[model samples]
Target: MPQIDPNFVFPVLIGDIGGTNARFAILVDSYAEPKEFPVLLTQDFDTIEDAIQSVVLDHTSILPRSAVIAVAGPVEGDEIPLTNCKWVVRPREMMERFNLSDITVLNDFEAQALAVVSLDDKHLENIGGEAAHPNGKRVVLGPGTGLGVAGLIRSRQTWVPVPGEGGHVDFGPRSQRDCQIFPFIEKIDGRISAEQLLCGRGLQHIYQAVCLADGITPCLNSPAEITDAALDKSNPQAVETLELFVIYLGRFAGDLALFFMAQGGVYLSGGIPQRIIPALRNGSFRAAFEDKAPHQHILKSIPVHVIVHPLAAIAGLSAYARTPARFDIHTDGRRWR
Candidate 1:
């Protein structure tokens, strides 16, 4: 199908699909706000189409003519099975089921990238850093089902989003203590990728590693358990686990900041950051992030912020829908018509 004109892609259905939840919304027109539906659990539905049907068509009198969806995995070919969830996305299938003429699929973090530039102060909380360069490049990465990553750059007047498998990149021990603890952090394919220690399972993985490093038996079984135990200071292992996790998160985020020279800012948006605000603000996360000796000055100049919006991805899609001409998003492979 040929690319659809942005000016005509209205009455769009925008969605942000994650491993645990799927949220839907409708942009009835270019100037109207999105009519958001209730969030649905991914386990409750067998496919994306089912979730849309149950939560959308069944309730709304207004039917959408187009859709812009953001899912938590790479958008390839026609069928997209999410990296952390079981629901697979087929755009052609959706177009036929919904009686649509156009649809565009986006990487979850790519949608987040769009949100970075469009969000107001009410939706963002500054973690640390100097004043942001409004037009400089920006990066958005977070620890969720995986360590999702995406970048945004200004091409004259257009904002172009950069997407890739940045989470799966090689990550290793940098300090003496990191060497001891990282050994037990587990590996995906004989290597310690950033996602291995920066996501939901990453917290638990670090807990087990902390126990083994100190000769203590592992007790916690879930991320929630570790988070609670750490926050309340009830469990020493959990404390170390969460702290180490924050340290590594800061390091990785700092790496990305340098990778893109994200002078605009480094925004954190994922399920975990919002849950552990105290730990992230305790100074350790920022320390590790700014610890890049040679470029510490440069990194310090780049601001850091945590995205506080509960429905950030949805908000990003809404921004694009409202002003599609502002972004230079290519729909060659990800779009269906």
Candidate 2:
């Protein structure tokens, strides 16, 4: 059960646990900077606690009194199973193993949204539009192990991070070319979801779909190969796949901008955006994003930035640890004591 009063004790341990990597940091005090540890691969550890014990506790004598974990899964019940990884976030077990007073869990994108709130200009590259509106609503979405989506809304002085399975929303072909190729794209649970065609595997899916649509033999098996071939324009099929990807991404971002009425801006996180900066900036992305018939004017003012921060989620956890009052995370049944 959650503690009656969720008071975050100092010397807190904060982590951004993803499907592939788990990053941790320690906030010793409000004034001191976060002491970040080495990144750990999820498959290398048997459990989330084991990785923490090996990389963090084993190396440093600085024990934490509390922990705030942002995982790539829904934060529910005592056991929070990661969507893509084998490791599970067991708050009860973590509390007992670390001898911590409290543990607060959050969705991975929720952490990303918090980073959106605290991030500055240097960590972002402008893809389109003007400067962000001060304290306005913002969204952060990206494709990595999967497509992650989250939004930030300001309420009084604190910012609220809204996290959900927005990535799984239905995405259909809008153009004639899309209709010709989208049928070959893979489907999850029978229907095509945004993540189905926008993730690392999604890149492969797109390449394969293009190959099948054009009656060509599929060669690229990995996302890296497809992306590299696309970037270099060494393969015509790969090039077309990348162009389609950019269009799909823009359409989704635009849709979210209109849905959330996000005036602050849309931040593209994850590894994909950083890799395809050139493709994203070639004007096709912005054009597809602004193609909404009646909503072009609204999207014009809404900016889009790609987050270039390598350790954004860890920084977000650090921010929450340092100033928990600034973000409304709503740790109701999530915090275990």
Candidate 3:
């Protein structure tokens, strides 16, 4: 276990790097909140080090002695490659390039999970269910460039984040409409993983599948167009696509809650959920979440919330950097202090 240095310097760098965007922030002091810097497009930079330098050196005057980067992919070995991005993050190279004394890389969802306890009413929009259990397990997930999942367990007073590639699990159809749509999805991708029909690309695929099922020519070109059409009730295919998306999201959340026994709550984060708040508040999401028989009662008791904080992962990474011992990070069959 690594010990927290009593003389450790202030002003740590924190980042939440996804496939599309890389968000950076700095924690100047223990009492001060993280100050966010302008977001950088991942494609603009060829390397993660370049992205970090562009943000840290160009904008801020503060020189950080350490950093904690939350990446939207599995963090393993020495090279952590993002699932949906072209850049590969090599920790040792970054440390040398940035002149950092210490650095930690975490799965994006692991950082999101760490932020669960830090979230308050202002950062959350409740969807359904009773109050969260005081000490029950909490599950955090969302769809952005891809789907991410993690669980938060309360050990003593600290929270332990359990990150996994839960998004890649086989997607199971739950409704008559789902059964019909699966064929269309399988035709395109050969196999239907949960992420295949739940993330940004997944939304587009769902729109295509809906159009095919209705014998209509596919017209929507992007996820944004589909969402816009659905929100305005302009296209029946887009509307149906959003409906199925909400239902599938609910089912997936419920399944994860069951798997983690998340009585604390199920939190929806990422770029997609905040945009589709109205669809989530509708009855379809809750109805599908509680549809599982014999376990419906348990599901009903689990609270569902949408994380509205834009820089939540940065806050999480900041917390972990300040006190690494407070978190239980599962990586390479080891736990860091």
Candidate 4:
């Protein structure tokens, strides 16, 4: 059994589920900060429900009446699947199991996209683009365990977050080098999605591919280790890996901008962008991003921003916890007139 907040009828149990980790928090009051802020290792808990239960036990005695979970999966037919983890969250089943009054499950990237609406300049680090348009449609993307992408539409006065699986979209190569690398990756993966070349694992893959391109011996390393070596300039291959990684990232971001028509601009969030800000600042990211054939002019106008805030998703979840259940406005701002 869980303890109940006698004063408040129902507290909000919020979660941000990702491929590698899941962050859980309990919002007891409407305006109070989360009482239980527990970040769980995804592999430790077999199920999301189990993880939720444990967090409730550790942080609060209250059994929440309503729960809002941001899952790293597509929300379809009341059920959602975790992108990298082995868990499926069925809102009705989970709510019934926990005796919740209401439940909402959203795409994790959607949550992250919505999260950026409230982020401030202090939370962002300008990588290689201009400032974001205040009242324009903004693009938010993050490459963690998996690449997550979403768009925010600004309506009359609010923001509506649009969910997408853009990461799984086909990879478009711009140059002869890219054309060569594209087939190489496709051969190994059978199909190379954006995730194949835009994430942490993707960084390693690019390093290996570059090695193959230059006919150098491949080196095995963790993402962090590779970044460190690349930054130090001690390893030429690592430096090349980072360079190619930025190129792919920029080109991919440019593609996203074109797809979303992100007039407000594009923002690169998650852990990767922050780690290589210097490289992104000095690298050929801008050239790659603006490499569209006919729409280069349009892309040049779209500013690309990078979010440095680590707690962006959590804060967005908090905002979602308080958002009206049936509002006319979508999370990004677009509303039904």
What lDDT does candidate 1 reach at residue 141?
A: 95
The local distance difference test score of each candidate is 0.90, 0.90, 0.86, 0.77
Cα lDDT tens digits, model 2, 1-337, are 8645545788899899888889999889877878899988999999988899999999888999999889998888988899999987889888998999888999999999999877778999999897788888999998998899999999979999999889999999888988888889877778999988888998988899999999999988899999999999999999999999999999999999988889999999988999999999999999989999888988988999999999999888788888888888788778887
lDDT of 3 by residue, 1-337 (tens): 9945533256788889898999998888877888888988999999988887777777878888777788888777777789999999887787787777767778899999988887678999999999998889999998989999999999977789998999998887767887787778854356689998889999998998888887899999999999999999999999999999999999999999999999999999987999999999989999989888899999999999999998889877777767766776644421121
lDDT of candidate 4 over 191-285, digit per residue (tens): 67888888999888887777777788877578888889899997898897888888888898998898888888898888888888998888589
- Candidate 3 lDDT trough over 10 residues, lowest sum: 328-337
* lDDT, residue 18, candidate 1: 88
How much does candidate 1 score in TM-score?
A: 0.97
TM-score of each: 0.97, 0.97, 0.94, 0.88
Candidate 1: tens digits of C-alpha lDDT, residues 86-144: 98898888898889998889999999999998788998888889999989999999898
Off by over 4 Å in 1: 1-4
Candidate 1 local Cα displacement, residue 216, angstroms = 1.8
